[model samples]
Target: MSKDTIKCKYIFEEDYNPLYVNGAQGGINSLGEIIINFYLERNALPKSQTFSVENGKISKENIDKVEPKDLKNSFVRVFQNGVVMNYQTAKEVHKWLGKHIESLEQIIDEQKDKK
Candidate 1:
């Protein structure tokens, strides 16, 4: 599929839980970016996992409070393919990438069958 034609979906904070907590902000943005990059690197269309953030403008101060390391760790979960890859890690992410590619291939096959 063309890169430009790849489908991407985003689930913002409003769709799940707020990213900010008592004075500490979560790493949703960084996590989201990581997920998108993960899909792009493997040539799979990006699909956002469900999440929610509160309404209102997120300030620089709040964003600054987010921990980058924590966000990266959290993003690792997306790659766990529910099999031997039960934990989030670079290896699991690669496995997930493979799964996504297979899924896309299946989709294409199904489309062809319908024709």
Candidate 2:
């Protein structure tokens, strides 16, 4: 892993299957997607925004028309690293993090300091 890219690996139960969930899921899905998505949605600024590309250019009009949807219907595939989190799982993680944020933040800070 390079300094600019932080890679974390998590092993969840197969039940956390991304299939029957979202599409193109996995990798840093937890600390990056799942947790971030949870808060973004809660704040009414969900991360469902998407963009379209044509002729090597992003279509601004398409981005503006993006919308949110149920995660299950969001995609079709298996997560490679972290698993997809349903609303229940997301809420549980959010609550747990609320109680352990300081510790989590400290770990992140430690990683950053490693340079």
Candidate 3:
């Protein structure tokens, strides 16, 4: 499939300093299953990862320090019901870093708003 099939969106605001936000939703067709992936990027590279939704909650760790080889291994594990996405290329893996950070920022913002 072409990379163009992936959809991404971003938003930015300027209040004293620039604040940026973005999110993406995509999927890969594998073994008759369409795995839908979600991501958010604020001001940096997006994280390449996926979450397992169970009972309306994410069922995976917010992974960090993931190497390309580790990603490949993870994907293999996931394919066999053992692990998760195996990121092969730097480009593919880097895509998720920003989203992870953005997600964290969003959580912090929500907490602040609640307080």
Candidate 4:
């Protein structure tokens, strides 16, 4: 090996945790850079809950918060994090996503032909 040669390895921090998101919302800021907030969407949850016990095997539960009448069609979006990037990075990401999306569509078509 040459004297100037070097090797490198990457490792995640101790607090590193994978996040799952299905939604994104944001726009540019005063600096003109793009701002994207990733989030997860799901049914709305009760604001609070309570329970009561009478015997070793007897119990009851109660939800203090009254759910809206339209709760059956209600939903919630919980933002996990946000990322900021310049126009150049956004264009690169756009191209990369388009290529991958086209490939995925082709794969699905091929699978359908096989069936």
Best-matching candidate per TM-score: 4
> Residue 10's C-alpha lDDT in candidate 3?
64
**Tens-digit lDDT track of model 3 for 26-104:** 4444643334343433333334655668999988754553334255333221111111244354346567787888999
Q: Write the per-residue lDDT of candidate 4 for residues 28-106, one digit (tens) a residue.
A: 9999999999999999876544566677653554444345545556899999898999999999999999999999999
Where model 2 places Cα greater than 4 Å from the true spot, the runs are 1-80, 103-115
Better of 2 and 3 by lDDT: 2
Better of 1 and 4 by lDDT: 4
Best by lDDT: 4
Off by over 4 Å in 1: 1-88
TM-score of each: 0.25, 0.22, 0.23, 0.70
Q: Which 10 consecutive residues of model 1 have the lowest summed lDDT?
A: 34-43
Model 3 compared with the native: what TM-score? 0.23
Which segments of candidate 3 are over 4 A away from where they belong?
1-88
TM-score for predicted model 2 compared with the true structure: 0.22
Instruction: Give the alpha carbon lDDT tens digit for every residue of 1-115 in model 1.
Output: 6565667898667556422212211222433322221211122322333333457643333433444524433432223111122225545687888999999999999999999
- Model 4 clash pairs are none
Note each model's CA RMSD in angstroms: 19.7, 15.9, 20.6, 4.8
